[model samples]
Target: MKLIGVLLFSACVVIATAVQQKDSELTAYKESFSPLNYLNRYKDAAAVRQYMGLVETGKMLSRDDIFSLFNPCHRQQMIALFETLYGATDFDTFFKTAVWARDRTNPRQFLYAFSVAILHREDCRGIKLPPQYEITPHVFLTTDVVRRAYQAKMTRTPTVIPMKFTGSVNNPEQRVAYFGEDIGLNSHHAHWHMDFPFWWKQDYGAVKDRKGELFFYMHHQAVARFDAERLSNDLPVVQPLEWDSPIVEGFAPGASYENGQEFPMRPDNMQFADLPFLTVQDMKLYEGRIRDAVSSGFVRTADGRLVSLNSTYGINCLGEVVESSTHSVNPVYYGQLHNDGHVLLSKVTDPKQRYGVPPGVMEHFETATRDPAFFRLHKHVDNLFKLHKDLLPPYDLSELEFPGVRVEAVKVLGTCKASTPNQLITYFDESHIDLGNAVDTSTYKEMVDIKAVVSRLNHEPFKYVITVNSKRSANAIVRIYLGPKYNWFGQKVSLDVSRWGFIELDRFPVKHTVITRNSDQSTVTIPEPKSYPEMMSEVQRAMRGEVEFTYDSHYRHCGLPHRLLLPKGKPEGMDFKLYVVITDFDKDVVSSDVTVDELNHISSLGYCGVLDGKIPDGRPMGFPFDRRIPNEEQFFTPNMKVLDLVIKNVRQKPME
Candidate 1:
């Protein structure tokens, strides 16, 4: 008996020790390894110095340059592989937490940029890294190095802008990014970080078989390769990533700023369908691996009649953290508005541009940055379709306000097919994309079937309080329409409660509760017209009155004066009409309402405007100052204090 007892005690002790060891390893893995670390090694001391010297010479990273890093395969898919692995497991706080935090961080979040700079410069044809640059290829994709980058980005003080960094550290770029501790999430005093895009961009490397490189495709060769063997052996796997858990100081759940951008529901900017790893198979390569990643959950068919018992990546509406209210997936907002080409610019190359324009606000033009965070969020968004269909039961499409808004698959925005209004990419799939293309919304007449999204739906309409506010009062007969487009003269917007009553409803009873018809309230009566224009004028007065408040209130003005502008130099001027289809990624089309008259009357404002003057021809003018013949003896840069004096006195006050 005593011997048996000793054996039992020994077994228990051994088990406990093993558990402790495993826990420690997991903890260390989460805390130490960060994408920032990977960047420094790729950058190294010498590479950083050279990059900075170039920057001082007015050289900046171009969109093509950063995108080039993802070519070939190995470099592009490295981080992508890790993100997949992070999602494979069930309730792994370390992985999910990191993904959510870093993805929202700005694209150029310095620490995140370190990795981008490394991968971007790796295959540069323009300039070769100096011979003295002593970076080993190992630096390109080392988990350990990534850990170091995170530490640096977190601990640095006094802020880490590149110019200042160049003067202090040998690798100013890396140092500034790695030691960007001062960069907080937002100004909320929240203890979080701010950076997301580049971290998402590192998911894949370029595909090639160079002497010093691996020639593997990301979805299949790299990720699915390990994934397949692990499933066969019945064991867990570890994945490499760019970074994790990027506590963005400003991004917290329920933040008044966070509107429709909830986690896991919609992909970033991707309203239709979460674009998965478009395999080469669709284009003639192998990409099904993405569809067959992990068999963790289940899904139902598109028609909602069939259900697959086993789908990969289980469903969790809420994350592991008890406080979080969701864990579906988010859509990717890839800087391009496929909803009909009206993006901030031709190529929203700036990573900063990915974020929402603060709903009713506008940010600086220079503030625009490409948001890679949207891509990461989109991965999860795609998963939501599967999870909702298979594991978690989603509401009926008919009951959804925008009924099946996400079911449609449109052209995944890749190439800029529109050189002019007439020239647009009509169709995009694996084989033929980037061609001048076009599409009609549907077989139906109205555009309602195109990309419209509502919150919920019900079989019958319900009571709703209608509030109409307009800036102009002409005894307006608020003519709402049954169709999605504006009624008759584009003068009013009418929503049908009979078809979309649940949309206005805030919440319904738990479980499945049927809404009955109260006989007395059978028909909700909307009688005479109200003076909506007066109400709207109150709000507009406040906006335009305080120049600082709602300066450029055009795009949001659905009531009146929010017109689409035509591209300049078009032979037939200002005829901007967009043909929209939920499934058609190509949005440029024709419409009668967006006539030349309306186009000519569109509001004009700059992405970044100065209080001094209004934007000219769709572009914002800088603090208006005359071209200066600076005294060679004088000192200061274009944005220096001395320039302010030159502009104030030398240049007249600009007017609207």
Candidate 2:
């Protein structure tokens, strides 16, 4: 009996040691991911000297140069680093390996390196990352707002800073700044890029299926939605930037970098000029070749061969060429038009850098949409995709018709009973965001929970009640879109002009005859992201077997914010059309290799494709509207219906 008791005690001691070790590993991993903990490499003598040397040698990373994904040297280095970290046997090993590299490498680059490894490493699957907004608050918040938050933290007085409109009323374009400068929208854009990085290679894991196509579709949707918002503000649709003309709209982002450097401003009426490395002629040449390919219905391959553009894969191929990804048929011929265009606009104000100004907001996806010019630049990019789409034959009647489906009636009912039918009520809502993790409070005796309140456009919970008669019990895809009823001149927008402006509201699969979908559950939107401490606590609980671990809804952060799903409408109500289409799910479903866990994590498949899986929908992105609409009657089928709706901005007390 005495021997047995000693044995049991020894076994218990071993188990406890193992548990303590596991807990330590988990804590280390969580700490490494803290965005605020990013080491200041500029302050390190060795790091500063190395960076200076690279810049003087003209070898530093530049957005204007060929994208790093295609740069052989850069690609190899990144791939090797990612593979090393990903090959770790366990989470503890992975955490230790990352810490070793993170301490030795450039801090900014290590963040990217670490994130990429986490995404592809199967061991790291289902692990929740803290909301990036808290990691790099400067990217998502104004300079003044962030500085004020820091002051509040130091003074031990937490305050909620209101996000005021960035520009004055003198600039008519500023009217829609609320939409362009939205925190959630910008965060979505930033997270989307991280999820589907342009540098992602086949070696990382599975290739991003139709990535090039997604690039075009995502940006295309953003610009289209912006145009609709502009219409709501009584402003004209965005005008594409002319290569030779001067940009009249000046942008003052008022946002700073983590290192306290402000993003450069571009004064109004700045003229485009030739830089030492790039010229106007180069841009024209690239555009001319692309247009020529679209007009001729074929693209020139690298080996001097012609590939037909009249196939299912045409858009994907075009997207690769336009984005100038490594998959492009001929990089030399196509050039890096899309990437270079961003660089040009970002540096136009300081083309020669004589003023020592850094690149503008256009250089970063997170801050780009804050400027009105971003829409104009993207409008130009959309035009290129339109050129290809216009040349293709319109989607025929047979392609759109759902033989067994007929939409008899559709109505949108808001949560508020007093609201009129087929009308959405929009209002300003204030949200308090904790900024504690955004600053380094390690020096303080007590942790402070700084906060900020931002006012954003939100709509009352609404549901779409559609009455459809199905000949048989079969699954179907319901696609919803919203567009302004009239053009800039108050004239009813013709189908040809309005088709491009339609903003997809939601896309989901349904089987019932009477289909009802709540606005809060939109497939294209994501719930409010949890702060660092909140996510950390949940992760810790799951690790200790205190709660069930799941990544079903929180896995993908690259989604439109649920709050801004509806655009802010005029006070009196803005006329808009709610278009719904029920299509055969059989023709739309794509076979995916993802596991059941990953399969359940898809929330924003409409805008931000599934993580490491097929795009899910087999139809060409943008479906019926992707092609030209010859006539309204011909375009309408038994499965499609258009309902008249109004969006009214309900007045609410402004948060002081």
Candidate 3:
């Protein structure tokens, strides 16, 4: 027994030593060649010479081989090839190998792909990421913004400057750009695509649990939020993009590439042209087919079989077909309407590429929201989804109600000095992002302090105190949602129209024993940013043996940034409705062995379902609000309560 114990101790020491050595090597590599600097540099290179040489040998490269190529332009082709070659392999082995290979590559494409793989890795849940690769910065400011900041510093130019307005300042449509152009919001949209990619694991089993349903819900929620922001700005709701109609609300992104090339700005009243890949007639045909499927209650599959669209799975199947993911039942007949629409609109200015004009901002996820046309395009997509949803039956009372549970009362408590009960406050705050780490300080000492000032919406932290009356001590899941009470004309919107507009604030299971929740404690919101100073202090404390190294298990790579918790409201305050619902946890809970840490790691659950586990809730993604209320006037009953809330926009005073 003593000999075996000694051997076990020796094995443990060896494993610990190996882990320490690996960490040391990673730190050394980061210090020698920062990934951020490499991403900035290689994105401009025309080709990766090393990778091209490997390709010339005529030896087939493995999926891992594709990750070693250091060229941003070749990423899409490489990813496509990777899926084709290794789709049937074990996902865990494929992911770890890709991550290992990513460390050796110096391109932004490899890093982006690796980062996404890490986030989606089912086995790597709750694993702590290195501070440099932490996703907070990426969530707060997108990859494009980071690249632009690094470029600005390298070129000795100002990071941000006010651009002259192309359209009349008084035009109400101009407000969409302000919210749409926000870096954080756009970053969230881009990350959602990465989280639930349309083309991942084509031959492999489904990577995510409900990719098609998430595709429908995430975009639907985005359009709803966009409408909320539009109404807050006193602008009319966004109109769907009709292919034949002229796009009058032209957008100038005021964006530049790392190479200092500026993106083309669409002129006022610019008309879309037929693209080489997709034409107006093709779009009309696709739309017609999808509408026919919705109206006729069936769609033709790839193998020429009619599939019903009436069941719950039917909508999901239809979503996959319309979004045209690789998992689509039939891509040939259904076609990729949503994605193709974005592609066609992106090339509206240079459909044939005759003038050497690159695709517009709509072409890339990172720059899509920078264009106002994106909202119009998505509004059209949402309208199509709504058309299908309208055909579904409304939720019955049994589906909407919870047994023996009641939300007695609920109120929000704000942290600001003048904050009132049930009132949330949004204000503009400037954040200075340092680019010194990505730039060479030795060459230009003056550029070390170079920073980009970004003005964005911020809200004071608030807490939710809900009083629930339960007969038993069973667990209950609390769902909180917010939506604008008034429509574009300042008139109260019908419950039928407003049901789809509700934005999920948070969803968590609470022991009937514990009821109150602080906003800072929300699992949906992005974890608070850890400042450099605070991180250094923690490091010092650990070095002095005063405290052990710690990781915030609550902070997950997939979540909405906490900085954008609240939308920007009007100066006087915007009238909104906060709805709270308490449902029986037994019914809502899915049977899973996922640990508490793993559960917390699913920060994007409200928007993007859990990675590998069953979606936490038993009900549909958007439960009560997903379908129409049996009776619109009877939405607020004993189990659910709608409370009036106001979000006031506070302007910061200029420094003297």
Candidate 4:
């Protein structure tokens, strides 16, 4: 019996020693294997040093050159070169190879360019990554919280403002920053630009289909969503930034870039100024030219040739020109309206480079939404697309009607006890995010979990139940949308006006038999393991054999965060309308030649488009909402209706 006890003690000691060794090895691996370690070597390269010196001297890189580096116009070439050298491999292998061959002119630009390539790669599709690692890192890395934390670790000083929200209540606009300037939303915007880049690839295979149309639809939808949030908070919808007027709503981001440099704040009521490259007159001139193109039904190319805007491709071409992509009908003639406007507004406070201030939030995708001007700017841009869309004939009943199908009733039910049928619940919930994951910690002996409690708008999970009347079990495409029932001044908005504000909630094929779906299951909404902690918990559980790790299954490279599924509503329940429409699935699916696996996993298909280079839906990007309603009103018959609903804000206690 004594020998048996001695043997058990010896076995326990051996196991404990092995566990320690394994953990030590893992710590070493993490320290050595970070992307920062590889990327830091290029910071001192001659090209990067030269660019840094130029930036320090207040020499701005040309708009085209800046975007080219940030988004790398030769992305396909970079990827192909990596694959040729390293062979097809996982993201870690491919990313490392690409980094080695990348232009070392700017470390930040290289980081943004390569990370974007990895996120959009077919092999890396649906890989579940921490939000910081995914796309939000671009924003988070620049935050005072993250910067201070990293600096403190290096100097052994206590972190100042380690994890606090940045903007203050100096103005009403600042109050809305909690929603408008969310890291996740900013990340989504940044990712969208990476997905639908302005720089066109020489190889057609590298370019996404309907790129121009998606540009219009995506930003248009953002404006719609912004309007919904505004109405919920008792604010009017965003208005266009008048070219001749002084901008009243000023922004103080109070945030920093990845290099710990704070973005210069634009004072209140700042006016647009003339720059050496672009002037107020130049902007007005470009606007007039674009307006002329819209009215004349054609745009003049750089070579003085007229390009007709009357065909199906007309809107696409117009979108390219207005957004001023490389594929624009004529970049020099049409002018870079959208891009230059952002640059000009971003530098309004220092247009002549007098202050030596870097461009404001509007200068880059990751920082753009932090400014109130961004929404107003996009509102104006959306109007440009609307002008062209209004010219197109409204959809007839035959174009919209789904034969032999009708939606009998539509209802939304919430999971929480406080939730009422047909009413969704939203609230200001505080989430504790660990910024440690975002910071580079190669030199640290132990990983620091710097936590910050940020207040954000969240909604209780809900389900949609739809009663369908159909004779056969055919597949039907379900499109769900949301819009305010009334305008800010308490007047019912016309369908024509409300149509522009409609935000797509979900789009998926439902069998005629299946009528119920949880909000978590919505194609437009991602399911929760919603935060870094939640994701890490699952990984821990899988390691301990408590749960099977379905990382690949849950990987969604593109989609809005699940927490942002609902717009923030008022405490007293804001009234809104939920619109549901069913179309024949057979007619909606687009035929494509490019092959990709698990196309169904590409959630948010309505907004994000298909990964296989095909527009998933056959109709116009927004379909029924893309065009005006028919005057006959036959299309709105019992098949689809605006169900009245309320969104109430609930107070949520912080989790322990």
Q: lDDT: which candidate is best?
A: 2
Put the candidates in TM-score order, highest first: 2, 4, 3, 1
Give the per-residue lDDT digits (tens) of candidate 2, residues 1-656: 33333322222222212220222222444444421133232123333344334435655444222222333455554444455555555555555546544444333344555666666666555444555566557667888888888898889886888767677898898888988888888888877777777656565456588887888888899998888778878998899987888887998888877656778888898877776688878988998899899889899999999999887668888888887777788879988778777778888887886886766778777678898888888898889999898888888888999998999999998877586789888898887776765565546647676777888878888899999999998778889998889989999968877988888898887868898889887888888887665655655565566766554424676888888888777889999999999998777777544332343347788788877867767888888788888887788998999999999888773222
Stretch of 10 with least lDDT, candidate 1: 641-650
**Candidate 1 Cα outliers beyond 4 Å, as residue runs:** 1-50, 53-286, 298-388, 394-656
Put down candidate 1 lDDT per residue, 210-292, tens digits, no spaces.
Answer: 10000000101112212222221222221221112331111111111111221111112321111132211231111121223
Over the stretch 5-102, how does candidate 4's per-residue lDDT look in tens digits?
23222222222122212222223223334232343333223333333344446443322233322222334333333222223234354444443333
lDDT for model 4, please.
0.65
Each prediction's whole-model lDDT (CA): 0.20, 0.73, 0.62, 0.65
The numbered model that scores best in TM-score is 2
Q: Model 3 TM-score?
A: 0.79
Count clashes in each candidate, considering only residues at least 3 apart in sequence or on different chains.
86, 0, 0, 1
Local error of candidate 1 at 425, Å? 29
Model 1 TM: 0.19
- How big is the positional error of residue 472 in model 3, measured in Å on the Cα after superposition? 2.8
Query: CA shift at 390, candidate 2, in angstroms?
Result: 0.7
In terms of TM-score, which candidate is stronger, 2 or 3? 2
The regions of model 4 sitting more than 4 angstroms off are: 1-105, 120-129, 133-138, 141-144, 147-167, 301-308, 311-313, 437-444, 527-554, 592-599, 630-635, 653-656
